[model samples]
Target chain A: MEKTLTLPSHITTEKLKDLYKQMWLIRYFDEKVDQFFAKGMIHGTTHLCVGQEASAAGAIAALQDKDKITSTHRGHGHCIAKGAETDRMMAELFGRETGYCKGKGGSMHIADLEKGNLGANGIVGGGIPLAVGAALTSKMKKEGYVVLCFFGDGASNEGSFHESLNLASVWDLPVVFVCENNQYGMSGPVKEMVNIENIAERAGSYGIPGKAVDGNDMVEIINTVYDAVENARSGNGPSLIEMKTYRWKGHSKSDAKKYRTREEEKEWREKDPIQRFKEVLIEEDILTEEQAKNLQEEAKQEIDDAVKFAENSPEPSTDTLLEDVYA
Target chain B: MREITYLEAVREAMSQEMRKNDDVFILGEDIGVYGGAFGVTRGMIEEFGPERIRNTPISEAAIAGGAVGAALTGMRPILELQFSDFITIAMDQIVNQAAKLRYMYGGKGSVPMVLRTPAGSGTGAAAQHSQSLEAWVAHIPGLKVVQPSTAYDAKGLLKAAIDDENPVIFYEHKLLYKTKGDVPEEQYSIPIGKADIKREGKDVTVVATSIMVHKALEAAEELEKEGIDVEVIDPRTLVPLDEETIVNSVKKTGRLIVVHEAVKRGGFGGEIASVIAESEAFDYLDSPIKRLGGLPIPIPYNPNLEKAAVPQVPDIIDAVKETVRFK
Candidate 1:
């Protein structure tokens, strides 16, 4: 068993409880998304982040209200973790009128700027530069904020990632570049796709500190990001964090997922982060077995309510075609 | 009063705006210590320092993305694309992000920024460097497109663009940079969406923008000699089009010729023609609405080919002749 290290100030009992609830919510939300897509209720492909709940919840655990995040295609978890409404996100996935983007932007493009989620972009490295820019703005305006940019191992090859890291470092902008090494980029495993041993090692070229963490371990994720966030808030510039996580499901809803063996999925499933967290909470006497069951049930009920809200929500008016173009 | 060229006019606009607002800053390739390729932002680095007068790497997408992100976070960013031809590289940020953000947020946010780039064909810079692509931006609903034909309009319009709650694409013809005009020193502004009737006439309405505005004025002089009075209307800003002025002029003369440097097919000229056709002006037309535009060919390496790719004085002359008709 990999024993993940934790910080003294990190993962308070209250915080862990909140993380458990959010983790359960995202798990239920992603599961419902899979069902909805299969039933033809949701349009377009969704990269479900079901088993990778700990990565999203733990990474965003210590983010301030003013902090910003840029997410990837598998971004619903990131949005929900950052406090975006489940109903609006589901509505956006449904291409409904009441969506965050009023159906103009579907699943991959869902965003709530007020909540500091810059939206999940269709392009792999599209949002990378934006995170750097937002951090640059924070630095220049003395806004005392940080920007966390999340991308897959595949995006490590993009010129934007390199260029953005360079710019952020040169300007000493408050940015945390997190590479969610989910072991695969649409069937191409991270091992096969990247030449580097770890994506975090790429940060050395930009003269920024880099580290690899157990992405599935909430304690590790919280501790690693806690230091990175603190350094940025104190004007120490950016950090490159590589989280070695695994995805239990296929890349998208339409994926046959025949590329990987069922045995491999079962092995990763046995090491599920949600189950591990639950076990940890019980072992530490932070949460009883009944409390965990009640939390999961609550999350399921909340997701059900969000689905009803999305189904009854009206579609955006056609007049939106001409609005929000420029302000 | 100061004797300044069109290039100087742009520099004055940028310097003045930066001085007036702490949020205002400039970013582009070779625009800081090296000055702009066309010298539009010369001396800006010295006046405002490298932080504000930022010289970015040769990355158009990054420039546009930076502007979009910075603007969203309450900073007014002014982006300069060394040349208009490279705009295609950043069309995603310009068209999808900056133009759509304000309206996408239900007008709750404004991208109060400017993208000033040197355009038009004449310095023999050839295809890859020389282009008058203002029409492309004008087609976008949320963007404000402006081409200042004189130093006075350049200074005034830039001030207005900086203060505007929308993204403004301010284009200065490459050749127009050295042309001088007597502009008042006191504070002034040219409204973003208004059209100025450069030379009023009764025979025909010659609606020209950017460099063509000057060509139309020259063409008007030649037409006057032939007893054909021409009204050359300079639509300073294209998106918030001054349709009222254009429609009124078309109604008065019963003839119209829409001229632009951009290639004809689906160009901004089509939009103007469509607007006139849809309005009451269609009933007052003495001839078909004529549009004189660039030849439908890629700008070539040869100076003459580049020159032929866009509308010139002769093209405007021919359009006016055809539309006015020989009574």
Candidate 2:
């Protein structure tokens, strides 16, 4: 494996190592969710964020405990990175009362406000503007916090994405628009869907700076997002940063992905973010191979526990449907 | 009290709310220096500056979605949609996120957000801009839909909506924007889900919303000349429907007519009828519940046809007459 990028020695290796572990945990949890789905142990659909872990972890690393985040459909990584309980997320997908949303929201709507994960959204381009609002709130409340919004390339084509960026720029909302451009938007390649060479370039229209980054390289993702987050917290308004990444799984389990060739899938697999991060940790001497293996095993065990908890949890009573549909 | 148009009243309500509360802010398209398309916010940018009276790009979803985020973070966001017909673009944010957020999270948080949009027909706004879709929002349980017929109710209800802890979809009739009424200078709030008795009669109860309420009042005057007394109940809020007021009126009059500017199919009027039919009031009825609303087709552009398609004074009179004659 190639040696991944790293910051100067002034930055703590421990921080980078911890980020690697968080990414690993999310990667493992996502794979477990996939397994549970295949075994019919989980209800609803799963949109795993496998190759896109670095972007989630990188942005989340810059956030304080009180900083907020809004996530899109492929949101497992974001939720996990933001500190949502794995067991609760699994229970939500299983439609259990013990779930984060009391079974009203499935895999696509896990949230933990205390942990600063505003929520996951089932709608494409749904959460972007909300995050901007959150950032605006932080600014208005004088909380000095920032909001990180994670959306896919498909959402970039949505009018909401453009609207949010422009509003954020105009109002100087404390928000960072992190576009996880994973090459394909449900089999429609980003290259074909948008004319711009990079999704970040579109931000220029709003008179805000935009940048593209190696989403698979954890250190690079962190460095870019950290700049944007700092700028936003300092009242510099919002910036759009597009992370060029990939998704190792289909859009959803029902998606056979007949539109693309296996060669394309195999090509993206070569740049798997999870594996790249691990190799970086090992090469930088931040973690030995043995420590990495133990961490992987530990992640696996935690995911197993989460699955067990979800399976044992009770389904929500029919009466609950009437209760939570309204506030 | 100062002389104000309906559009001017709405602007006053919003500007006053924003000025009074640090949390209250306005976000919409061309809402800043350009005012609004209808001139509702004509002078807000000059007073509040761009910070509070923010302008956004053309994304209805973003307007709503950002409002959702801001509301979640404790800033009471007042979002303005230029046209009600365009709400479909942000249906998920309005219905799924803003509406359901408070309840889904087990009441841990509330979406104290208000969406102000102009609805109903009569301006040559054509099919896309003139359709009255309040019933769609009222159908959702999490949403509290309010349509005030007069400037007094508009200001009072808009203030109440801003103070409300849940998501409220506040609708204004495009046709009603020019209509004005007496309003108090002192701060006051009208409760949501409460019906106002516009007129009292022993013969029949005319339950109406938005512009239809005025039509019902006008019809009541005409019906009085014919020796027929008509009671008018304005259901200012639709979702948390004022069932008691409606049922009591139906029981008293033994006849009921429900009216609205929206299309007949699944119009909020149906819900009131259903409540009356399913209640003990059904036995009190000397006649079946009559519903009068817009036709089940696109709102036409021609002034004559457009006015003909929706509920009017004549239609209200006809419906009240039909209900009174029913066995």
Candidate 3:
């Protein structure tokens, strides 16, 4: 492991360690999903956020329990970072009755309202407008809460992105639009789809603050989200934040990934957020090498327990198909 | 009971709902200051202020998605799509996100929001502005579709829709805005999925919706002189579909005629027909269920052509007569 370091004044070492643990949890959860899927345990398809763990962990770390988040199809990371239980999420993926959605929504629709996660959307850019609405609610009720909306580079090109940004800006709603620009939208590269070099620049049209940050850098993402959240809660209006990152896995379980080169993948892996953060924790003496190893083992154990819980859970009742369709 | 225009009744329901509940608010294009495209919300901004009565950009997806988000956060948001045809722009939000969120999330959250829009053709607005796309929303598993034919039903149903736990697509016919009818001054809510028997007769049942309800009723009145007693039924809400009322009505009359202004192909009329066919009513029928809907063609700008595209009072009269004459 390489050595590197730094921390803000108020943030304790324990919190940083927790954030590291969260990133690891996201990584392991997605890996487990991939394995289970290959073995035909999980039905349907899933979009995994493997290499983008830092963005989810860092951004969510800046939010309060009262604040809300809207996630994309690749949302396991966001759900975990926002405090969704691993057992329920895993059960959902496994199509068990104990799943977050009672097995109705596989991986793409998991949500924990108590944790302030609105839900994950399967359609690209589908959750952007929803965040704006949540912000509208918070603003109207004078609730000091900000909504963090997660979408991708491909979704930024969707018309909903432009419409949502404009509405959020014009209404001065309390929201932070976080664009996880993971280099590709399905098989197409970001460069080919977007005209502007950065998705943040498009926010200029909406007259809101817009900027880009290193998504893989946990500390950087946390700081950016902190500032955006503050601005939103203080009624300064919405902001557009672009987190430039890369996803190591394919867009979904079935993707052939014929678009990107292996060399590019190798480069991104070298800058893996988890490994990078692990090095910082050790170098700064926040955790010893032994402690770091123990934390990884702890995460593995948690995941194991979650898998067992999901496997042991029963399937949804066949007679209950018509229930919950209305209420 | 006092007479009021359909437009006034719509405004009254929203105003009453907002006055009763602080969480209820309105958001859409030109809804705040401009009072919407048809002046339905003209005085609302002054009373509720810009905060509660918000004016959004011309973005249908944002209007819809934001409503879903706000509803998830415990707010009752009413989104206006300007015209029902514009619903196509926000289909992903309405069909995928809002419709699936509750069931997919294991019923942990409910989107108690109403999406209101003017539908049907007759004013020469042509294709983009004048299509009745209720069937598109009704086809979705998790959405409730409602259409009110009169001023009384409009106010009552609007109130009901605002209070519904699920997302509702409320279609208000454009031509019916100025139409007048007896409405109660006291606040009341009609059950969402119940069918109202506008007129009772034993010869045949005319199950019509929205503007078609008016046409069906008029046809019934004309057919009375010819000894063809037609029973006109308005299925105020389509999704939950008062199947019992429809089936019972068909059984009593021994003949059924389904009418709507939407294109005939794949319209909600087909769904109603299938429901009757699969029920005990199929054996009691004196004649096959007659499905009457608009022609499967884009509504043209010319007044004559626009009128020709959809079923008018004459067509309803003819269809009712044919059904009564079948056996």
- Candidate 3 collision pairs: none
Candidate 3, B22-119: lDDT as tens digits:
99999888987788999999999999998889888788888889898899898999998899888888898899888988788887788999999999
The digit string of per-residue lDDT tens for model 3 on A137-243 reads 88888888999999999999899999999999888989999999999999999999998989999989999999999889888888888889888899899999999
Off by over 4 Å in 1: A1-5, A8-10, A95-98, A317-321, B1-3, B103-108
Candidate with top TM-score is 3
- Which of the two, 1 or 3, has more DockQ? 3
Q: 1 or 2, which is superior by DockQ?
A: 2
TM-score of each: 0.94, 0.92, 0.96
Output the worst ten-in-a-row residue range by lDDT, candidate 1 chain A: A1-10
TM-score of chain B of each: 0.95, 0.97, 0.98
Evaluate every candidate with DockQ and list the scores: 0.46, 0.61, 0.84
Docking category for candidate 3? high
lDDT of 2 at B99: 81
Clash statistics: count for each candidate:
8, 1, 0
Give interface RMSD, every candidate, in order: 2.4, 1.9, 0.9
lDDT of 2 by residue, B104-155 (tens): 6655577998899888788888899998888788778788888889988899
Top candidate when judged by lDDT against the true structure = 3
Q: What range of 10 consecutive residues in model 1 chain B has the weakest lDDT sum? A: B101-110
